[model samples]
Target: MPKLSVVMISMNEEKAVGSVIDSIQEVVPDAEILIVDSSTDKTAEIATEKGAKVIRQYPPCGYGRAMELALKSASGDVIVTMDCDATYPSKDIPKLVLLIDQGYDLVNTTRVLTKPKYMPLGNFIGNRVFALCTRIRHGIKTTDVHSGMRAYKRTLIHALKWNPDGPALPVELLIKSVRHGYKFIEIPIDYYERIGNTTLNKLSSTVWTFKRIFCKEYFD
Candidate 1:
């Protein structure tokens, strides 16, 4: 069996990290947890107690850069990534790993069908619009381009050659994966709102994100 590594990127997530780790631990007891945290709180300390290897990221760094650092530090053949906040069900991790073992290059978790409550309306609009853009530009129809929950095989990760190094990295991942002929699919997964503060300022970040992804996908 291929080893699975669960990687999470977070900052000041002391409130939700424990539950997220606990849930993933329940599903994949043998799976290793690697946390890349930049929290000023006790996030890293708490993560270590929960049996996760913690790597502290510096401030002024984007989520994409932190995730890149986390992924590079991972030691498993199959990697599953999610936010440090307990918005995604770690219990569904095995499902993603199973799909990967069956040979899918990338497995995306979609909350669209799951109909998670408390999700921002702006997020819904942004997700649908971005999904449409990705389909039209890359011929890949994905239910959740903004979803933080994703599983990917190590080989496919290399094939994409992604280096966005910013928050728009997930979008880059899907686009490059499709461009490289890698197989990708979406599976329904439960979603929830975060327990603590959110990193995004919806209206402002949405505009910025749209510009960033549009330039990378269409112009550049």
Candidate 2:
């Protein structure tokens, strides 16, 4: 079986990080769990106790930087990126790996099917607008352009460059993957309310995404 590497970026997620790691272990016992944590709380300590390789992101780097650090440290055939807030279902990991084994280069998890009521109306609208922009500008057809959970071959990282320093990393990944002619697949996954306060500034992130889309930074 190919080795699976699960990379999660966390900050002050002590309440949910341990449970998330446990869930991932239950589903993929042999999988490597890498946590890029910049938490002021015990999040890193908890993840360490749970057997996850913890990389303490010093000076409090942003989410994109954290993800980049985790990706650089990952050593697996396949890479799975998700949040450590327990919102993403670890039970669906096998299904994602199965898709990758079947020759898909990238598999993105969509939260639209479950339609959690806790999702803010502004975020829903922002996501739709971003998806529309992607389809119109890049001709990539995907339902959830901003979904956090995704799996892809580790080698695909070599073919693309990530530029966003904030929450726009997911969109940039999809855009680059499509531009590079990688096979893409989307699977509907269950969504749950997050356990702690969200650090996302939806307005700022949305503006950044739109700026990138219109300026064609994704192509460059």
Candidate 3:
């Protein structure tokens, strides 16, 4: 069996961490699950109890930083990234990793196939606009930009120089990966409502994040 490292980031996700971890273990029994958490609640305790290797992220470290920390700590050939909010289905993990075995460097969950009806309108619009910008500016076609669920070869993480410590990390990863010549593949996955406290401020965060990515892509 190919070794896999599942890197998950969470913040105050006490309510949903157990279910997410349990599902992950079911799908990837041999996979190493690492939870890089910045939670104020019982997230760490629950994750540890669920058999996940837990690491506490320091103050001011956002989702991107937490994910980067987890990636650095991972020791698998394939690295899987997802949320601890339980929005992403753990059952699709193996399918995502299977793309790596088939020679794809990176795989992103489109999640549009089963779009959540409760998703905010601005978020929906932002994702569509961002996907179009990625195609027009980066010359790569993608259906989702801010989707937290993804899988990729560990090597691509190094190749892309993806070390963003802010909310712009996802777009930075996509753009830099394209610039660095990594193959991209998108898989359909279900999009569900979040289970824990949300860290996103939807409108403001999306606008600010897109401004950063757009400016970096076009002017920098």
Candidate 4:
């Protein structure tokens, strides 16, 4: 069996971090839990107690930077990235790992399978719009380019030269990996309302995702 590593980036999500950790443990018993947290609250404390390797990303760096830290610090054959807000389905993680074990290079998760009861209508529409733009501009067929939950093989991750320190880094990852000839797929999952206060700047994130969709590297 491959060593599975669950990586996440957190910021003041103390309310949901512990439950998120426990849920992952329940699904992937021996999975390595790694969190790059810049929480001002007890998120790191609770996560550490819950058996996750808590890497303190102090000064609250950008999401892309913290995510890059979590990904590069993981020590597993496969890496799964999710948010600490507990909106993603942890039960679906095993399916992602199974796909990796079945020879897929990357497994991206989608939350638009059903009409999301929890996600705001604007966000739902925004995600689909971004997905459509990506399909047209970059030729990637993923339906949820901004979904935080996804899986990546260690070799495919390290063999690439893309920087994870930009807006919508996942978009860049998908584009770069495709350029490198690696395979990827998107699997749908149930979505839920976040457990804590949302710190997301939807406007900025939206602009950045679109900017990344049309990045010059996509044509490289």
Find the 10 residues in a row with the least total lDDT in model 1.
Answer: 211-220
Provide the overall lDDT of each model, using Cα atoms, as 2-decimal numbers. 0.81, 0.86, 0.80, 0.86
lDDT of 1 by residue, 8-93 (tens): 99889999998889988998999889998988998998899999999888673877788888778888999999999888988889
What residue runs in model 4 are displaced by over 4 Å at the alpha carbon? none
TM-score of 1: 0.92
All candidates in order of lDDT, best leading:
4, 2, 1, 3
Q: How many residue pairs clash in each candidate at the backbone level?
A: 0, 0, 0, 0
Q: Model 1: how far is 9 from its true place, Å?
A: 0.5
State residue 176's C-alpha deviation in candidate 4, in Å: 1.9
Local accuracy of candidate 4 as per-residue lDDT tens digits, 43-157: 9999999999999989987888998888889999999998899999999998999999999999998887555999898988888888888888768888888888999999987
Q: After superposition, how far is residue 160 of candidate 3 from its true place, in Å?
A: 2.6
Query: Mind sharing the TM-score for model 4?
Result: 0.95
- Angstrom error of the Cα, residue 38, model 4: value is 0.5
Give the TM-score comparing model 2 with the true structure, all chains together.
0.96
Residues 1-220, candidate 2, lDDT per residue (tens digit)? 7899999999999999989999999999999999999999999999999999999987787878998888778888899998999999999999999999999999998886434676777777777778888889888888788888999898897556887486678888887887789999999888888999899988778877876666766565
